[model samples]
Target: MAYKSRIVQIFIFIITNFFLLLIIDSASSQNILTIESRSDPATPEDCSNRWIHIRNLPSRFNLDLLTNCSDYPLFDDFCPYLANHGLGQKTHIRSRSWYRTDPLLLELIFHRRILEYPCLTDDPDVANAVFLPYYAAIDSLRYLYGPDVNSSFQHGMDLFQFLRSDEPGIWERNMGHDHFLVMARPAWDFSQPLNNDPPVWGTSFLELPEFYNITALVPEGRPWPLQEHAVPYPTSFHPQNLTYFEAWIQRVKRSRRTSLMLFAGGGGIGSAPNIRRSIRNECENGTIKNNISSSSSFNIVQRNGVYSKLCHIVDCSNGICEHDPIRYMKPMLQATFCLQPPGDTPTRRSTFDAITAGCIPVFFEELSAKTQYGWHLPADKFAEFSVFIPKEEVVFKGLRILDVLMGIPRSEVRRMRQSIVELIPRVMYRRHGSSLELRSKKDAFDIAIDGALQTIKDKLGDTLEH
Candidate 1:
């Protein structure tokens, strides 16, 4: 009887230990699951796992342009704009992210950003896209002023040959379909005809058949989209982080707007459109036609008095506005609508500047904003944030621009302004050395990269299906 009792006691001890082990194992698994849940969340739309392989092009393609920056005729001293990895000189104000940025340095800015991209792979075989850090804009500037039009084609041709000979495997993989480069100038600058008498205004770099398959990201793209796609023009304000970005948005929202309209560009210049000259004429002469109602037919309204009360005009005829942000940005910040007329190109950098200031841009041409920046700005939702008046109606039909603006209902104005405020981040370029926290908020650079990658992916998918 004693032996049987001892056996039962041992059996009970073994059963209890087994049950304890089972509970411990189950608790460990639950803890692991909790940790995993905290670490991994749903993937963000802006975030990508696609790998980019940055091409190791010869120095002449990129760095050489910076070394000889002073020789560029466009700027008196172009070297200063080459600082901070193409961010230009810092404003030097404490806690302020303002820079004297050159609008044509997008190539340098993009190169720096891609160098620090998280998904960059050294192996071309594993890369989903190839990034060519070629300073095409700066390179073309040298040829713009020279009498030799044929020389414009040399640099681009050399770049093509180098890629074909050095990286034949990568270049031939998709026939350059997976590769991309940023050209800060307008697409037309690179698409000059080879058969012009006095040498056309731009280079023949983009007209090359070898480059037809390669994607070109430009500040101003062609009217009909092809290999060229539009990207945002660089603005002065580049927030350091998400905190600064959000703060600026709130400040713009809370600030009181005293003026109804603002125009910060040139008027009397030879290149200025008649519509721009007319707007300037109206603003400077303080012409306000009170007899005309919003419902009035498109008839000429005689110039009157006190137009300056509603519209603030910064005559950028002296070219001060481009170098001095305070001259134009302040007016834009204080105005409800910023007039964006077609400048040298169908688009102007001022459109982006207004967007950054949280000022609702009023475009006079469809190519200025609607069709140009579809990658950055929503094409279908233009009405929510912007106002468009056909240049033809304003120039030909004698439509009163001021009266039309004043007629927008206050509620609609508020909603439009609010929409513009929300769009601030989409049009901006974050400062270099931005934290991963800041990068999580997709800015212009991120959007451009994502668009380029998606283009390549779609093309590759189509090829595979065929």
Candidate 2:
């Protein structure tokens, strides 16, 4: 009788736990939103109605510059800096960061993707938009980091000469208004220098008159600019297919976020007053300790430009500071929020990584999210997904990072995390060397291409008419 009673109790406990897990899974699934790929059928009409890519441009200006030009192989000389169609060296087979794409290599990725696009045409007569397909970023990098900084301007000059001398009629076509160029770096890198301003380290690609009419799809577009469109900075998170992306979303959504927030970068010097340093200082000052218990996991990494020291003052693991994608993402996945201070410029690629990890980003500057309306993020949805505190208040003033974050209600934080998880696909670069063949699955590259084509159609109006 006693043995039978014990068996019955065990069965009941198993049934109760199983039902509870099902309920939890169902709740999480409710929050997971999948972006449906558009059902637009592929046809000759689709191809002809889309953008026309220019085939006459010098190969040296783009592909050869990436292939033969060997400058930035600090990791491995054999592996080209512009490998895997500008997605960089594949770092992992399962993770998109396996390729380890350089942040400034988006131009190479964009050019290749555009060439492989289903809408690409052999003739320009039946096209809506013209893509220049220039690797100006790579060319600039070769010169910028080289011994002669002034030589960077020559690449821009050479490109201008090619456009004027060889393709004069191409410029006359819509006066270059229907054309566009994709850049991997920030717009400031290629800005035209002012008369008395300190020397900046980029080519005057934006200053050239021929390029004035062209739309620039840059990682960081200047605010209040109409011609420049902000694209996602290349992040470490890359999903191979729809399955990988969906799996990641489900996994991150279900992660146990024990930490209030994390700061994964080093201190800054200019623009904003080293906000990361301020946050680190505040954490040490017992401000956060007074709010959360001593058992909390507030992991902070003291990173110099090269080496990083994981100051595991709390009960954090060694995996917190590992450079590998899984280890790097682990902390983010476990945190409620990720600190995103401006690095060199106002924008950081980690901002997108935070979104990809389903962690709400705490940004210091407005331009970090505000200027990026054209490609990845929606204009009006900033407040719904992220937390923004002005730099002056956070850094200059003695405001505590923990106090500000801990003040948000748990329900609101959950809502924000769900919103961020929904946005993962928008900011991720598709796995490189994947099938270019037509498929229903659409990734970040496909979305950007679609958006660009639509913008061109809207701008050209009757020009694309039959």
Candidate 3:
């Protein structure tokens, strides 16, 4: 009895010490660097030997841009976008709303994450990649919508001036090939051609010769890839920890699926109708039956004065969606397949949101899912998890989307749902809530950073040792 008691006491001591060591180690790491605005400029020695060196561009590049949120008349429309960060002031948490239609929040969230990333170093010397945290999409929103071409061009112009300056000496560092930028908008928005054609919507920042080598991380990349890499758009479901993610996955797996398929978007119209037009027609024609019904007309005019139709959006005319995030997610959870037609661009964040809800996505365009998320999603598992019916077959040939989805076996659908559930962790970003201190093995941010590093290594061809 004495011997056993002593052994138990020793075991307790060792366990307690192990946790104590962990706490001390965590404290030491926190003390290593403070993630805040700094005045010090990055030197050659600071970047020469780091894995990732974030350029300490003036606050104007990020926060200052958001400082004039009041200037925009639709400032109240930005509550959800600014809830996580202080868009201007820390507003009250009125409701659990996830009306993230405008992807400007993606850049804001990413900026917060990279600052807190463990790989982030104060020194620039040992860096394999340089991150230029610029909120180009957010800044140009007003100009893109208005007739202020010079105002829209001003943000890009300022970025160019800073990049070309001798202060940071970023020009000499790998000729900007190793440098990367993240824009929440589609690639086309930044690369509007300066030809004799009618003016484009977005800033022509990307068309500049100086930016040719820079890696662009965007929500939608063009088919013929230059440097633009498609990253997942910000979805409403930001789990605070792995437990919430795992619980949601289990809930989705066991939940009763009463619907065969669901489409949570509005109808479209016009001469050059997108795939959504066919989807709306099919739904109205009783070809596709939605478990939950919504009705509206969202007219979205694209660049060059073309009318693009959109729907399934909660009324944003009042600046905010009245519905809760769960309302958007419930249909997806109850359905076997979620219809994912392009929205404004070829890719929508709904594709990722469907994956999170454990629903198999039926993509109209291959680039919507197949080519976009190469970093986190496995190429081989595309067929195993998703369904792709080309837009031509749907719109031109009058292909029946419901017939194709119903043809897929129940067992196959179950397998695909399980596959999607398994991908929940990799695709979702962890929220900086209570579990911010508790680390995840890896998440979307880590996957993107690792992908960026590997891509640089491949392109540089042995120049980078990291």
Candidate 4:
């Protein structure tokens, strides 16, 4: 009995000590440096910390932006944020709502700078634009928070619509110009674009088309991928350039990030039965994503497989949601494998988000996983990167999610985490390619913004001479 007790005590001590070391080691991982606004705008609060300014928008937009950027909100005391809604913890008020931005809860938003893309294809328009302010708002947030900061504007909804509408030169007007779409809310109805007050306009500055003159001939440097040919704007790069770059850098920094992986699950706008049926068979039995039924939109029917009780599917539109941090913390932490099947291009945070929470992403092949970011996740490298499932084999073809995970070897799952840890430095960036410390040194955001701003500045430069 004495011997057994001593062994048990030693085990407990080791376990406790292990956790203590983990906490201490992880402390440095949380360092973040926010970009303070150079000029305080005519707004309610200073733009110093996370507080920002919009020319004619309400305080709501600014607050939301701050919330999105921080990923970790410090506004519990300052604003009526928790009460306002969707940061996960909901406080019933005049209406029921799902608050966004719970540290453990990940939500995706599809935003379009619909206004910035009014088809200004003129050569003069593309030359002198300075996209700094626009990018500053975006990249700065991305650095501090994980890819939890997600929005698609450039090549997502705006382009798809322009092409489908076949408006004269619409694609020509916006092609090759790199721009990020910052969004609030999750849909595309032109009327809903505006609320009670000043209209919230989607904004992005135009830059020279990718095919434009470039100093790519820098004697001795990585030959920058030639900007997409005369396509008018940078289409594929919009949604994931930041993370891909960051992941690439993360690999360099951590030397143990995941390498090859894919995230495959969920429909674009919401979970559609058709989508659910289609994705069921991609996996083997007893896998993670398999348990969640893909049959219903925003469907919680299959959630029990992931959760204990059938948690109430709270109404999301009105405001905050029932914040269940405990429910998600373990899931988020243990989910080294997350699935993001193909359906919509605009807002699929479900995929990238899996990356943020330290999960390896498993994707369906329908979307442009690699061509978009030069990221190729082969089976051998699967342990290093995301896993991409081709269209035909998605387990849920009226199949099952459990089968999907079972189909892949447990070795593959562990390999995915290895890839992510290795790629974290390269694919993710706080400043552009800066270290996790949010250092200003060429952050992944800066790399994208700098290339973009250089073009915009040149264009806007002439205009300022007046």
Best by TM-score: 1
TM-score of each: 0.84, 0.77, 0.77, 0.37
Candidate 1 residue-wise lDDT, 167-253, digit = tens: 699999998989999999999999876656566678988888899888899999988767899999999888877788888888788
Residue-level lDDT of model 4, residues 229-268, one tens digit each, is: 1101110111123444455445323432221222233233
The alpha-carbon RMSD values of the candidates against the true structure, listed in the order shown, are 18.2, 15.1, 13.8, 18.3
Candidate 1 Cα errors over 4 Å, as ranges: 1-49, 269-273, 286-308
CA error at residue 54 for candidate 4, angstroms: 14
124: Cα error in model 3, Å: 1.5
Clashing pairs in 2: 89-99, 90-98, 90-99, 91-98, 91-99, 92-98, 96-238
- Expressed as tens digits, the lDDT of each residue in 45-98 for candidate 3 is 643433676776665676656644435653334432454442212122542223
Q: Candidate 3, TM-score vs. the true structure?
A: 0.77
Relative to the true structure, how large is the alpha-carbon lDDT of every model? 0.76, 0.64, 0.64, 0.31
1 or 2: which has the higher lDDT?
A: 1
Candidate 3 — which residues are off by over 4 angstroms? 1-32, 35-50, 73-76, 86-102, 150-155, 196-198, 269-274, 287-324, 433-438, 462-466
Looking at candidate 4, the ten consecutive residues that score lowest on lDDT are 229-238
Q: Could you give candidate 2's per-residue lDDT for residues 57-156 as a string of tens digits?
A: 7666765564434455432222233445455545655444455656666876676555445565545566677787777777776656655465544547
Model 2, residue 443: distance off in Å is 2.7
